[model samples]
Target: MKKISIILSAFVLLSSFTVLNTVWTNDDPHSQLGFTVTHLGVADVPGTFNDFDAKVTSSKPDFSDGVFELTAKVGSIDTRVEARDNHLKSADFFDAAKYPELNFKSTSLKKAGKNKYKLTGNLSLHGVTRPVTLNLEYRGSVENPMSKKQTAGFKVTGTIKRSDFNLGSGFPEPMISDEVRIEADGEFVK
Candidate 1:
């Protein structure tokens, strides 16, 4: 009976470890989430969020059944222009004071082509949530020499209309285009 009990305990411990292996966290410093918008009908202005985090869970190494959840601080937006950045954080734009974070959670992922996938998810920004689809390209994985852990990289790109989220509403397209291009270079560690 004691031997049987020990075997059961070992099985439980192994099961827990297997479950833990499925979850991965963002290596925030090495990861980036950014966006671009047409400025004055000519050049595109790019910006990045300085603070963000994400968690990914997958039962397979290929991430065919992966789930992702991400949150980014609205106040961390940077476009290399302080005045414009400040304005973006104001009531006219993201309203960082009221809505502090932007969030996304994956609903589905389907193969689009080799090493590419169509990821559909719910994106919440400025108190509004909507479905968004991103083209995700798996950048492959590597073993970190220092940490001796596996790290995976992905590039995600998508376009969303600011008007869809009730953000920066009523702004003429030529002044501030309705479309925003989203890009993320995400690194996840297991």
Candidate 2:
């Protein structure tokens, strides 16, 4: 009976931490939301979107939320290589002409620490939706510089196989790695 009571207590304690939601908005005066991946694992490349949006729910405001949804326009793909970027926009990869957008929506979140979390979500790319897990690090919350609204900071990361989305169809044979690392650093509204 004592062991049963102790087990129940532990379960309740864990559940308390699971009840949280944190949401963020993309409104940086400096830049918009975007992502980039290396070509053949070569260098640090960067890109930005003119418009994108993300939301999250977590037990704490400082970390990922219990729910998360991120959406970006496919036409916004920019690697500073115009021809390549255009290629990415074509049917070979995102099929932006048909798909128009890429998105991710979280189904579950679990705390890894006071400022860390494991976020599981479905990533829809090139029309294929797959489960992905992101190692998220909460950087704390602050007042927005312009609006003075409460905002949270986070850096999330995950990797996905491009082939799974039919994105590497025309590569010249092992030209680009099948795996692409996705890193997201953004601020969320509380």
Candidate 3:
């Protein structure tokens, strides 16, 4: 009886330290995934993927052990210009019909500074997969007045080379910049 009581106490103590992982999904109406590229070495053309989803899973309050995942529909790219948007979706660029989606799954999330983290992940775009590092900023969590649930905000920013992904191979740097800037901001809810 003494041995059985001791075993039960140990199990209860161990279970107290076990943290349940929480999954936070993006609040779609408040999230945006956007990109910018320099055009003709002068003007910057901005675009966005209107249809995308992102989620983070973590067992800790600080999200230090969080795993992030995202998926965006290529066909939903919008640059605010019909002709330009259509061209970007064509064979010369993204070829949305062939590569219908962009995906990202984070491998690591390391704290860099106060509220900042280095997020390294595999970004699959245009049928190519490449490792990319992005800057992640945790904007804190708050209770929503409307939903009354906890919500956390985050912003991710990064730059990728079009040449690395074989995107727009025919367009030279003189006409279209090789570097693309990525930005994503979202509020996630449990």
**Best candidate (score: TM-score):** 3
Candidate 2 lDDT, tens digit per residue, 7-54?
Answer: 999999998878444445654553255556566566656666555777
Better of 1 and 2 by lDDT: 1
TM-score of each: 0.90, 0.77, 0.93
* Model 3 alpha-carbon drift over 4 Å, by segment: 1-11
CA displacement after TM-score superposition, residue 94 of candidate 1 (Å): 0.3
Worst 10 residues of 2 by lDDT: 22-31
Question: Is 1 or 3 the stronger prediction by lDDT?
Answer: 3
Candidate number that wins on TM-score, 2 or 3: 3
Better of 2 and 3 by lDDT: 3
**Model 2 residue 28 distance off true place after TM-score fit, in angstroms:** 3.9
Range of the 10 consecutive residues with the lowest summed lDDT in candidate 1: 15-24
RMSDs, each prediction? Answer: 2.7, 7.9, 1.9
After superposition, candidate 2 runs with Cα above 4 Å error: 1-23, 30-34, 40-49, 62-65
lDDT of the candidates, in the order given:
0.91, 0.73, 0.96
Model 3: ten consecutive residues of lowest lDDT: 58-67
